[model samples]
Target: MTPPPGWYPDPHAPHLQRWWDGAAWTEHRRTPEAPTVPVPTPPGGGTGRARTVALVAAGAVLVAAIVTGAAVLGSGDDGGAETRTAPTATASIAPESPGPTPEESASEPSADDPSVVEDQLNGVTFPLVDGWVRPQYVAQDDVVMTTDGTYDCPGDGTVCRHGLVVSRTVTANDETSPEALAKADISDAAEDAYDRDAIGQKPYGGMESHELVKQGPVAVAGRAGYYVRWRVHTAKGPGGYVQSLVFPSSVGTESPVLVRFVFDAGADGPPLADMDRITKGIRPVGDAGTGGGVGSSIGPTG
Candidate 1:
């Protein structure tokens, strides 16, 4: 029988942690902070379980639909402020984007393209900088890209990379305010990437602490959106930065899309400028340019 959805430490390897399904280990994992409630299993019943697994296997090829392929809001604090009035600025220039077609739900962009992560399911693409790569790593279904290689984590059980970027649609909730969603998701992003390693260790010693660094409205892929960034201090190594950026889809239903980032702070980490470059370079897929498509960059100011 499947046990439940929760994280347990590995006894033989105290530095490692793993996610146990009732009968075995599944891919996604997390760390506990304070005493916490167990993450409920994604709702699936007797009949649905088999079909859900089968469908996921197929979605693996195309990246699935926005509603099915992205994140459901997780339990995080209201870390961002209420929406603020946008500061006046010149809008970026770009060709208008056409809505994505239903057929795109099955299209897979080349991860090694070195220029863009054409997220057909989410109806947007992220630009890749010099040191990043699209990776298929541990618990990587939602991971769109990461820095070139791994480093020794401060804790045990798993390796660490200097940077990572993940994209997910906020499919579970009805909220559409980008500020509210970005604010609510940052804590979860920090915890997921740093605070705990589902497989066994606290990568940066489990986000020792954090402070909001920036928050405000911005334009992503020509859509109005909001972002929240934080400077996180971990229990070990040089800590890093994490951001949650939320924008609406350009295609059907205009669902909210969530893009999360993680970057280590020291010299070995990816330069922070890449974050801004990536944000500015986001474009709707099937656009005219490849290396540096014209996209919007009006985002939160420091």
Candidate 2:
């Protein structure tokens, strides 16, 4: 016997099966095969595991944001006073606005450009004016200004630091006023150079004496600070060098923004006058306090 067209008897056990279109059986025989065993996963299950992973990722992002915010706030103490009052008006020569030098003209912006000098050291950014070169060596606790270059003039056995510098941590603060900081930094720089008369000296020609000029109270980012530009119109040792100094208000973990533009006196004019102008162009990087753009932080100041 022959089975029906749509039905086929199982040869192995005499069970019946239904035929599909043409190729094989559509319905199974009376006796079916045992189901395959499934592998067991952890109790969490796949969906639960996916959810756990997502939660962990979100948690990590939140932690990172919190850490970043804290870092921005707890980095430095920049809430110093906005002191720009000029020092005692000792005999000083009036400064003429000198134009940018060839080298400076190529690299520095105009006097009105709102660029700020950035000194990044010890994980803090102190904005200074342009024309301020980072010193290779400085006198701060964390920085060291050296005299490896040709000491054009030596005072007390130290090289006359009279070139582009690249020092770390040049700006700093210590519960002091900005004016106080500028004065102290300028004085300190004079001392550091092993020259007593290079910074605070007077007497240009005839009966004129040149003094340090302090200009600022300009908006450094958003915080208030000042730039001190001074000139020493005399000869130190035999160099006949006239020095210019730039000091910014904020301080960092490394040092204050101490910059010097030196020129040998008896030249046409104070060679650093233009340099001072270029330095003046530098403003604070971002706004001073919170609400300022990136890299800005807030601190309490008296």
Off by over 4 Å in 1: 1-114, 289-302
Please give me the total number of clashing residue pairs in predicted model 1. Answer: 6
Task: Give one digit per residue, the lDDT tens place, for model 2 in 167-189.
Answer: 22232445334445555565444
lDDT of 1 at 149: 79
lDDT for 273 (candidate 2): 43
Show where candidate 2 strays beyond 4 Å.
1-117, 121-149, 154-158, 164-176, 194-210, 213-216, 233-270, 283-302
Q: Distance (Å) between predicted and true CA of 110, model 2?
A: 21
As a whole number from 0 to 100, the lDDT of residue 180 in candidate 1 is 98
